[model samples]
Target chain A: MSSSTTPALPMHEVRAEATWLQRNKMIVTPLLFLLPGMLFFAVYVIFPIFQSFGISLYRWDGLGEATYIGLANYEELLTDRNFEISLVNNLKWLVLYLLAIPLGLFIALFLNQTVMGIRLYKSLFFFPFVLSQVVVGLVFSWFYLPREGLLNTIITGLGFDSLNILGDPTLATYGIIAAGLWPQTAYCMILYLTGLNAVDPEQVEAGRLDGAKGWKMLWYVILPQLKPATFIAFVVTIIGALRSFDLISVMTNGGPFGSTRVLSFYMFERALSEFGFRMGYGSAIAVVLFLIMLVFIGYFLWQMWRDEREARRG
Target chain B: MFPTPIEKRSRAAQITYQSLLPLALILWLLPLIAVMVFSIRPFSDFTQGNYWGVPSSFELFTNYGMVFFESDMPRYLLNSVFITVPTVIGAVALSCMTGFALGIYRFRGNLLIFFMFIAGNFVPFQILMVPVRDLTVDMGLYDTKLGLILFHVAFQTGFCTLFMRNFIRALPYELIEAARVEGVAEWRIFWFVVLPLMRPAIAALSVLIFTFIWNDYFWAIVLTQGPDAQPVTAGITSFNSQFVAQYHLMSAGSIVAAIPPVAIFFLMQRHFIAGLTLGAVK
Candidate 1:
């Protein structure tokens, strides 16, 4: 009966001699194969998402008896100063983090040449992305150390007062973003490199013959062909920007004056930190963030669905 | 091809380009280079403010030795290995089966299920945090390596499934059709025909997942705590506080924590890149 749906398989002759399991293998097999993964994913990933939304409507310490306080957690978010700061910073992150795409393209273009040991150079440029964000955060924190850091060493040597980037509230977020871009740009560069590798040589030659050169060639001819790569680069960069938790956690811990608190770090601080166990409040923050991310996720899925449809047709 | 090859350029431009490449690389990696230098220096150099100068003495072994034996760094590292390895194995294993099921079957809700995995993979960790932590504690697995491992595996499966299913889809349909024509059992076909052909995807996903799980700081902290279960990413925080104001030790510890993924990446460079840029071409 299950084999009826599997158009790719023809089991008519074998069906008469087979057991129920073998006859229903197409459906049963996939269901059996999907069960463990789906169960685990549902238990760990899927259910928790809805549970978080449910939990957000109630005020409960994680361990204590819960009290339903419908929408209070979210109402508080409206007036919360830190929430405002975090929201603005998230916008800042969203906009600035995209710089990695063009920056990555620039680097990829720079190193796209076939020279001696260029492969090694490409790998070296991509080095920062391989390291954990914890490590990257640590390294950058040290790099921003006012007195002992390399940045200041160069600054002081150049007859200027050494600046404390991370300690300043206004500059701290940008400081972290710059550290983030180091790896993110590297990631984007690799994407573009791979994209550039697949670019049609004939079209490039045609454009060149028609008097396209330098930026004009890149903008008119190459960029259109690199659309898939740019799309991916856009998706990952957006995700990376929003998922900027580890670096902030390590660098400032929502520091100097609670200036660097994005929704992610702030949510953790409320829910789990020594300040208090405001699980409901944290969940509300997470929900807002989830909503923001949903926009991008929906866009990505629609694009993918379109591509999948195209692939099936073509 | 897009930029016109350097061989097509002038001689002076070529020499200048060659010189700029290394210089740009050095500048780009300067922060990491500084950390490497700091890891090799004695504490005296930092105290004396000799940061940019030549190290007064190289104490690489001593600092790293302290991190290994004197601190809980070794335990944290071992926990990271235990947590990461199992998660990699479990996630990859589950996804291979899931990927095969989703990729090959023409069932109702196939695209829906595939989209579920993809969308879940993109969700923020914070959304899953409060409940996942609660769930772990209720199961009496909190602050244990196994707790971290289970959560990592489940979370990572979303991604691994997306990767593996696409890889399986790209495999020749004729191969599976031919196997079906030979009257092979479905499971037998998966095991004998598809699984063997999936070796490259398996290898690529292994290294990719290893790097991701190893570098995962968010879940490590949320699901576990302390040296007993915390991976190196979290452990490095405690290690830093222990050696607070001890820049040399912190540098050595971070470098040690970062080495595994970096080594794996360098060794499996081709497979690593292949896994990363999977859909970029299309």
Candidate 2:
């Protein structure tokens, strides 16, 4: 995504000013520009990453003196049933959360036309993505409210029954995820819709000429072109799954006996909430989550690096 | 274009598409629509088992007024504004310079620094929770709006820098080159030549950050507590616990909390989408 094709600072211009400032321009200038953002980024982002890992190796409450407890936090995480549950729930989230991509693509394909009021439809469809997940969680909570909730009302009206979805340990995570997928699918749809708009018309026509249409055309001709959108969708979906904090916090509070707890919420419960301020344990969970995220981040950066290099070569 | 235009299809197909469009949209937005309608109805309706009926009387003004006056919603909303507006300005301001530095220059660590910002933007917030909270407490920033604002600005710079550097990179380098040739100071070149051309990027980022910061709920919980400095997102969660079964008031409060971002999305839809779908289309 590097922007400039033509680099500035042509050779002749470098010698125009013999002053010390101009002589040292390249080194001094960029640093001067970068200082403020780097200062903040280092203190809040970079430094804390290492510090979090350091804290993970200690046995300390948030209050007092720290004691080194090497690997205890991580070792405990191995046997902790709640940690196991949260880890398993996270895996479930990653798998079920992937449904957003195809669901979004289906909606994108459904709505990717020049019909009347299509723009309104597009914006409305994407409206949920704009609202806070807190609101989404609340709305769904109300929608799933035991007997009088919409889900139960409809079920009871049909001579059936409904369960307290948010209160059921087995069903809770899936219930929260259903609420989550509503906005996530909308997000993915918008990405694919944009990708679809930019697909090559000539290639589509060429595919038609070769007797390609429908699923054949989409698979062979169009899906390849939508690779960028798919990659972004995958990246966001996976990250969103990992960062599944706000929804769980709002909907269940890792409730129904902590069945819905992802690493994020569980870490918060251990470190910050009323459970106890076990900073070491919280940071240990965080470090594990960070390692998981690093794998994805490293992959994404490598892909971008290769592409940037390939761009110059091509 | 991929599936072939539905316009050229049969009349029945066109009618089906048109009808299904709204139906699908309504079905998709059912939970939200239910909440929106519930927000304006009187509390009597919820108590009387009128969950999905037309309101006996519209309490739009009453509900919203209560949210503003009878509750801490106003304070929470104000806290959101105080925290969000400054973070947007600070982050965008800093990123403009960082983006300029990394985007235009071919320094020793240009790609390294750029990659750092890109990678840092994706780190889990929980990873920063313990140490960041400790840092804020050490600075006397715990449970304060300024603390939240500073933290948000710093954290957001990673993303804003990514947005801005790419934005600046797309601008013509010739403009900067010409300014340099005229013996203009480097900072002057950035301010006069580059900054004016970056208005669209600034607009895109300003709106994008506005929505991102406004909709942030996790940090609001991790950093601040109570109505004193808690933003509306976290405040609403507190409201949920206090006002159990009071769905009308909760619904009203939710709408109030959601208004700013929704309004921004409508007003600056173009820039918001442009910023969000930056690389999606290739």
Candidate 3:
């Protein structure tokens, strides 16, 4: 109103004279825009995290809960053989899953060439990553079927005895990990392939001039430039390792007497599975997994924070 | 370029590289190829112990028809479509606003909020399982597609926000500034200026989220049940349980379930990879 009468009024004065909501548009607009997403996120993702933590302190079934068991769930974890096995298996997953990055890098290096049908090869190599993990798990399970399965068929053709990959307790976790790695390695390979495209050809040529060929050239010249890709690969690989559920869910269901159980699957089996709805025990297990993820999450955030600072400086 | 590019190598080396390429690809896709082969094989082949032999007769249509017409696969596929399309729209719509707010505005707690989305995304789903299910049940939405859709929309927002924020942040700030100087409304600045610039990001994210939500299995089992609400992944798993020995039919079902994502990936191959590796190269 004041701006209409006073035509010479500056923009700021007009903005100030506007409605209160208009005057505070910057703060109000962002909050207005953020409201719906934040509400849903808080309700579904954020709050449940704490809710799960609180439920961990008690021993309540999902329905009609009224029992405060005060750390009994966590205490039980210390002696729980199942939890112990799951943790060990998860550790194995984390360690073995790292192989994907290097394996992926190797394939990427092998295929990064100007050749016929290279693009087709790249897409085909990425085929596994596109399929549902359910399908991958099923396919691998079929592959590992005793005598009739493809893997065993090949093994028997070579005069080796058949192995029930998903049936053997000792080897079941490894089988599932191998299946998981198929798609994971494809994912990392794509990342590295994209990273390879961004590498400075000039630096690589200079390194070759300095007699850095073969692995030496890759290590000294190329690898440094691929740090971003390597970091992402590790992040994704590690996260995938911890969250190894679908394959286990589809292929084995933590079976052969739960030898292949990882924390994520174990959490589900305890809390939501047909056996029982031990919500508190499962939440406790989930809390443990959350803390484990927090270590990597911290490192990721710290690295990103440092990168942000550098970006700001530049 | 990092490798020796094979052309400069000796003839023997080049020949070996060329031959080995197909061999490696075949080995890598052996499982998928096996599944495809099984999909076309007649069930009589499996009954007669011809699992590894050549198909007695190609029954591609018969197998796929059974999966589509005889089984509950069609309903499950429809459930997936219903759940996924809405989720893609909801998550993308939510993130566009949140991404604009966080990406364009310099505000207190901006990093905190954005990182919350990132951290929430990385946290395992196990933590949210019990309560979210309970919450859905309490709301009388358990076993409903809407319940699953709502949960997915919320859960995926964590990821979609991180994606959109980075995308919108990379857009030229001058466009937004110029709009503001022209006295355009703030929402109009978003609707007309930044939103138009976000087309590629939207396409990429839509394809990515479509794949993610379509491929989801955990929450499908957690929140929904039966052919009424369960997606193809969970449904297919249940189907596997029912017909544990029917590899041919199972393979056909898997092929049916795999078509949408595989088609999307091939059609939008560039966008799919771009979305997957968005943060990696940078």
Candidate maximizing lDDT: 1
Q: Candidate 3's residue-wise lDDT over A178-287, tens digit each? A: 99999999999999999999988899889888999998998988999999999999999999999999999888989999899999999999998787989999999999
iRMS per model in Å:
1.7, 2.8, 3.9
Interface RMSD score of candidate 3: 3.9
Ranking by DockQ: 1, 2, 3
Worst 10 residues of 2 chain A by lDDT: A1-10
Q: Could you tell me how far off, in angstroms, the CA of residue A152 lies in candidate 2 after the best superposition?
A: 1.9
* Window of ten residues with lowest summed lDDT in model 3 chain B: B237-246
Model 3 achieves a DockQ score of: 0.62
Per-candidate alpha-carbon RMSD to the true structure: 1.5, 2.6, 3.1
Models 1 onward score TM values of 0.98, 0.96, 0.97
**Cα lDDT for residue A162, candidate 1:** 92
Q: Candidate 3 at A231: error in angstroms?
A: 0.9
Ranking by TM-score: 1, 3, 2
* lDDT per residue (tens digit) for residues A1-314 in model 1: 24454445555674466667765667788889999999999999999999999999999889889899999999999999999999999989999999999999999999999999999999999989999999999999999999989999988999999999999999999999999999999999999999999999999999999999999999999999999999999999999999999999999999889999999999999999897998998999999999999999999999999999999989
**Candidate achieving higher lDDT, 1 or 2:** 1
Give candidate 2 regions above 4 Å deviation.
A1-17
Give fnat for candidates 1, 2 and onward, in order: 0.79, 0.77, 0.77
